[model samples]
Target chain A: IAGITQAPTSQILAAGRRMTLRCTQDMRHNAMYWYRQDLGLGLRLIHYSNTAGTTGKGEVPDGYSVSRANTDDFPLTLASAVPSQTSVYFCASSRGTGELFFGEGSRLTVL
Target chain B: GESVGLHLPTLSVQEGDNSIINCAYSNSASDYFIWYKQESGKGPQFIIDIRSNMDKRQGQRVTVLLNKTVKHLSLQIAATQPGDSAVYFCAERATDSWGKFQFGAGTQVVVTP
Candidate 1:
């Protein structure tokens, strides 16, 4: 069903470089979210979009940004990535209610 | 408004034994809860869910219990197997929010032979 698709399954980037993690959902969900999972820590929300044309900041939204131009795509951008940004990034979508569907995840390594 | 465990914990169990995973939530307004299982190199998959009104729910060989008074939630797996080895997470949804969920650090389960 390809519930959710993420690009660049894994990546390695140098500090100060820019990177964007792409997320797409075929479920036509109204809401999408970006989260980073760190070792020994839980998944922290980075950014979220309630619907197309609207976005909201989450707990850990400092080094990242997201855009929702349509119902199917939400991309997270890291402008000048830092070493601390090294973690696994996950994309999720929901009907704007409760349950969520997640992507396989994108592992990012910043050196 | 959202809080999760600061560190991940591991639980080990012998095959065929029952496994219990626990989680705690702080927000009293949170009325919906869910459990997810994540395997190596994979996304978190839904296991079971429970709302505030109910104290317990059961699925195929799995059970979820909710205790609103204590703000604690638990997942019980019967007949643990090697395939059950994974990281389990608990997420709670606050009332009237835009489907926002707060996730716990997660508990890693290791099933031994």
Candidate 2:
């Protein structure tokens, strides 16, 4: 059903470069989220959107930004990628209040 | 910030045996808790969930127990198989918050055949 899909399965970026990770859902969910997973650590929220055009900062949102122009798409951007930002990024979406459906993931490596 | 963490970082169990993974949460106001399983290179997948109003919930061969008094949560997998070997995480969502989920450090399960 292609519940969720993320582009650029993996990428390597030079330090200080800008990059955007794409996320999309076909379930028409109203809520979308961005999280990063590091070794020995749990998934930390980066940014989330409860609905289109609305965004909120999460637990770790200092170096990341997200935009939800519509219900089907939410994109996360890294203005200046750094080595610390190298981690596996995940995108998730949920219908009003149900369980969240996550995308495969995007592996980002900053060098 | 509220914190959720797992008591054990790794667990090893023999096939056909039951395995239990534990998680402790610090937020007393959290109303909904969920368990997710993540394979080597994939996103977290939902396994089971329980709400504050309930103490236990079961799905397939998995069961989730919630102890609000101690703010502890656990996931029990029956008849552990090799496929069940993966990292498990517990996440909590506040009752009034939308799209906000706090995840605990995961416990990696290894099944020996």
Candidate 3:
């Protein structure tokens, strides 16, 4: 059903470069989220949107930003990537108070 | 700072034996919890979930136990198989934000045949 689709499954970028991770959900969920996964650390919320046109900061939103202009797409942007930003990024969507459906994930390596 | 954590970083279980993965949450206000299984090179998959009001919930071959009094959660798998090997994570839904969830570090379950 292609519940959620993420682009650039893997990428290697130089530090100080700009990158954007694309996420799209066909489920037509109301809420979308961006999370990063690092070794020894579970998923940490970077940013989230309860609905279209509303974005909120999450636990770790410093090096990241997100926009939810529509219900089907919520993209995460890294203005200037750093070495420490090298981690796997996941996009998730869910209806209110329901289980989340996550994307396959985008693995970005900042060198 | 409230957080969710796992009791063990890794667990090894033999095939056909039952396995239990433990989790602890510091947020007493959390009312809903979920268990997810993540395999290699993939996103976390929903396994089971339990609400704070319920002590235990069972699925086909899995059971989730929630201890709100102690703020602990557990996932039990019966007849463990090699296919069950993966990293399991426990997450708590934020009371303030019904759609927001905080996840634990995770426990790697390795089922030996």
Candidate 4:
């Protein structure tokens, strides 16, 4: 069903560069989220959107931003990526509550 | 300030044996709890979930137990197989929140054949 699709499965970027991780969901869910996963740290919310044109900051929202202009797409942008930003990024969506459907993930490495 | 955490960082189990993973949450207001399984390079996949009103929930070969008094949660897998080897995380959602979830560090399960 292609529940969620993420672009650029893996990437390596130089420090201080800008990057954007793209996500799309065909499930027509009302809520979407961006989370980063690091070794031993688990998943930390970066940003989230309850619906189109609405956004909110999460636990670790610094240095990253997200926009939900429409229900089908939500993108996460790293304005000035740092080495510490090297981690796997995941995009998720849910109808309103309960379980979340996550994308395969985008692995980014900042050198 | 409220967060979810796991009791163990890693666990090893023999195939066909039952495996248990534990989790604890600090927020008493959390009403929904879920367990997710993540493979080597994939994102976390939903396994099972339990709500505050219920003490236990079962799915396929997996069972989730919740203890609100102690703020404890557990996932039990019966007849564990090699395919069950993965990182498991516990997530909690506050009663007032719509979709915001707080996740634990996660426990890695290794099943030996």
Candidate 5:
């Protein structure tokens, strides 16, 4: 089963450019999340959606925005990417508030 | 923002030995905690989890302990193997939104054969 998949396994973007990381889950879960992982730091939640059509800001959502248009897809967009936005991004989905199934990750490098 | 900090950045242990990793969270409203193992270039994988109502919970060779009183959490691995070498992360869920999970810095484990 394709639990969770993220598009653009890796990307290089110029600073100030806008980019969207695509995420899809085959599990049909209600809760979806976006997180960024940096060296020497754990994954930090960017945004989360408890259900379709609802999104909420997470710990680090200043430069990121997420939309849950449907149950299987939750996309995270980075507006005006900066050097500090360079990190590995992961998308995860879970049923209700239960355990999460995560994607391999999309590595973004901002120059 | 509340911090979920780990006690150690790296841990080295011999194969077959038991290993313990510790974490401390600053949020008092965290109701759920989870341990995740991440290998290089991979997303974190759930190892075990413990709720605030329970002090300890065990899985195959892994165990998670939660101390709500101290806002501390720990993961214990028995019979550590070389395959267990990876970074371990501890995460706590906000009571307000269960899907909002905050993670700690993480501890890298090196199991020497």
Candidate 6:
């Protein structure tokens, strides 16, 4: 089964440029989340949506925004990319408070 | 204030031997603890989870032990295999936090023949 798919597996962007990372899940889960993984640090929550049309900020939501337009898609956008935003981004989905299923991840590098 | 951390960054075990990974959490209110395995270049997958009310949970060849007394958690894998070579992350969720999991950097496991 195609659990979760993240677009642009890897990307490079110039600082201050706008960018968006796409995420789609076939599980039809009610909740979705975005997290960033950095070296020496654990995965930090960036944003999460409990259901469609609802979004909430996470621990490190600064410089990042996420939207759950429908049950299947939740895209993360960066208004202005910065060097500190360079990291592996992961998308995950879950049903209610159940376990989370994660995507392969999108490696982003800002120069 | 809550934090989850792994004791060792890397662990090497011989094939067929049992391997144990340790984790520590500072949140006494954590209701659930989870272990996730991430293969190279892949997203983290659930291995097992233990609730605070329970001290241990078992799955396939994996066993998760939670010691709330010491705020410690451990994952034991029976008969280590090459497929078990991956990074293992420990996560904790406090009571009232739905999906807000506090994660650790992860421990890398290497199984050798």
- Candidate 2, residue A30: Cα displacement in angstroms equals 0.3
Residue runs of model 2 more than 4 Å from their true location after superposition: B1-8
> Model 2 — interface RMS deviation?
3.0
Worst 10 residues of 6 chain A by lDDT: A92-101
lDDT of 2 at B74: 96
Residue B62 in model 2: shift from native, Å? 0.7
Off by over 4 Å in 4: B1-8
The regions of model 3 sitting more than 4 angstroms off are B1-8
Model 6 ranges with Cα > 4 A deviation:
B1-8
Provide the TM-score of chain A alone for each candidate, in the order shown: 0.97, 0.97, 0.98, 0.98, 0.97, 0.98
All candidates' lDDT scores?
0.93, 0.92, 0.94, 0.94, 0.90, 0.93
List TM-scores of chain B, every candidate.
Answer: 0.93, 0.91, 0.91, 0.92, 0.91, 0.92
Give the alpha carbon lDDT tens digit for every residue of B52-89 in model 1. Answer: 99999999999999999999999999999999999999
In model 5, the clashing pairs are none
Q: What is the TM-score of chain B in candidate 4?
A: 0.92
CAPRI tier of model 3? medium
| DockQ by candidate, in order | 0.59, 0.57, 0.59, 0.58, 0.61, 0.59
Q: What TM-score, computed on C-alpha atoms, does each candidate reach? A: 0.95, 0.95, 0.95, 0.95, 0.92, 0.95
Give the CA lDDT, 0 to 100, for residue A68 in model 3: 92
Model 1, docking class: medium
Clashing pairs in 2: none
CAPRI-style class, candidate 5: medium
Worst 10 residues of 2 chain A by lDDT: A38-47
lDDT of 5 by residue, B1-113 (tens): 99885354889999999999999999998998889999989888989988888999999999888888889999999999999999998988877867778889899999998
Give per-residue lDDT, candidate 4, residue B19. 99
